[model samples]
Target: MSENNNPPEEKKRPEGITNSYRERLKALKQARQYSVAGDIPKAVERYSTYLYALASYFGVTEDKLSPSFFDTEKEISELLLISHAYWDLSKAYDRSPNLHKESIRCLDQFVKFTNGFKYQHINAQMLKKFIKRKQAHNMKAFQNAYTKIQVDSKGCFIASYSYGPEHTVTNDLRKFKQAIVNYRLGFRFVEVYYNTSPAIINFLEKSGIFGCLLNKVFIRPTLLLISKSARHL
Candidate 1:
């Protein structure tokens, strides 16, 4: 197992998922055409090639595979499509657990990825909603520890806890702090309230800035929705 230092950048996730299915569909159709033409060997070869592609797509050795092994979104989608193809293959070959396992893998991906917000694709507004929820808890902790709160000149609400013990601060708080820095990059005033829950912590840990401080710091008390009218100002 050699690691690739630079993997190919994917097309946007939705497009990539669609294209994978389209390609496999074409391959299956071609195999069907060969079968109808009475070329059994060629049909089998085409299917074998398709199966190889599916295995490669999921990064698994065909003989030793499991539903648990397929984790990434792309891998799961690939497995789902391949499982459908396997059903098609059963018409030509003997049905076995080996062939049916792809369906199981698809269900595994669905269960694992669908149960949490982190796996779900969300928009900017939804993301902000999650941030606001997390910071609510952080704000409570902040208020309890350091009572100092004031507005800075740039319109940022600063909850200064410079003297507060570090132990009181959690990873979610650090992430909320980083998010505020990013949110206030252009605007002068952003409100920050503190508190947290699972949604924000998951976002923060994946954000690559969990423990890392921003060049500037703050957290938002509410989700900011700048409309067209506000943009002009």
Candidate 2:
């Protein structure tokens, strides 16, 4: 008298994900060796080559395949190589002509799921940093919000706006402790400050202040790019 029944669930995600990361670590080490052995091209090539292969544990990629999991989202969230592995796979998708847009989509999903806030919490250091960034935001926004809007001889309404903050402390040690976390995990933070988007890009270009921004950034273990507007003297 047997019935169709499944066995009780068991924990599985951590071990596989850990093992996969370890294997990738080994591959990266080999890539370095190749570089040291004077095979720079192969070394660079090996760095992110097998990223998609590591996605088996998650229900990612073309296949909806996932390892037997007690809890899916939490397990993926626990992956230690969350930064590098996902970045590599995202690039893999991007370089593939068939998967270019898909790659961005995949990366967007990964970014949403594992932002710095999830990886790092509001510890004492971060709280102080948050306060500082908020202060900078307020000062700059007020400065811009109050500037007079002028018009030239032409029908054009003469005005200017900025990416704001107009400056980031770069590693700011305090303000970007979260960004440092991501850097320590081996991914670079490459967004413009105060919100850099296509619209912002167009605005900056139209305002003709994009060049000065190149000088204000602090690039280091992490990078910070900020911009603000000032009427020409």
Candidate 3:
């Protein structure tokens, strides 16, 4: 007889609804409503409660979560935004600035943790914008202590998805850097009013050399302290 040497398969993880998940979902919906209605404190309360539910129901620590029910990428992304969302809501509290900071930190961590992320629809571009925002926000903090300003470094293309997957690399870091530099100047935005429309995003995504990352938010180079090279910007 042939030697039998198959190892036992590990037990599959259970998928059952706990009372806490139901309560958390209920509260998440409430939080969504409150957020839309301009009642931020209630929204914050609901979100905090939802997190509590998450911690308790999952039988893990505050940061640990059930893999079956939710994705780690999405959960962490939302959590990072929580502080920023709170900051935007309650002007009286240290919510906005601090939370914005926290959000940036969380986002940065997430970027390091995962290979890539698609925020709403935009992938690499969203984090790039977030980095710009954080640079501006933190610059203000640094302004009090120093004279000269500072900005974050340029985008490093880990990979690109320009029409399926392109193993070929395009060194457009200069163009992206120019985009930020131009933004720091007084260049007006092209207006992203149809943010609710994914079709528009899809259209743009399909029609472009750069795909979805080429939205107007990132295009239209900054006006010159001195004019930059046309190709780079």
Model 3 lDDT, residue 109, Cα: 30
Q: Model 1, range 1-233, lDDT digits (tens) per residue?
A: 01222224544434543355335545666777888897755766676566555445456655443445445454555444444344334333422344334434332333332222222222112223533565322333222211111111111112222212232222233334444444544222222232222344445446666322321232322212222223334
Q: In model 3, what are the clashing residue pairs, if there are any? A: 87-95, 87-96, 182-222
Badly placed stretches (over 4 Å) of model 3 are 1-17, 35-39, 57-60, 63-116, 120-159, 163-201, 204-233
- Across 1-233, the per-residue lDDT of candidate 3 in tens digits comes to 01222212334323332555545556766877888898877887776676566565556754443334345453655443433333232221224675655444333333332222233223223334544565444544223111111123222222232212222222343243435544634222111211222454456667776644564334323222212443444
**Per-model TM values vs. the true structure:** 0.27, 0.27, 0.38
Candidate 1 Cα outliers beyond 4 Å, as residue runs: 1-26, 35-38, 57-59, 69-77, 95-233
Task: Say which prediction, candidate 1 or candidate 2, comes out ahead on lDDT.
Answer: 1
Q: By lDDT, is 2 or 3 better?
A: 3
TM-score of 3: 0.38
**lDDT string, candidate 2, 1-233, tens digits:** 01212222444556655465446556655765775697755654665543443454343652232223323344443242333344344444544467555545544433433332223221212223433555332333212211110000011100112222222332132233332324523112222221233344455456554434532342211232221111110
Worst 10 residues of 1 by lDDT: 148-157
lDDT of 3 at 229: 46
Ranking by lDDT: 3, 1, 2
The TM-score leader among the candidates is 3
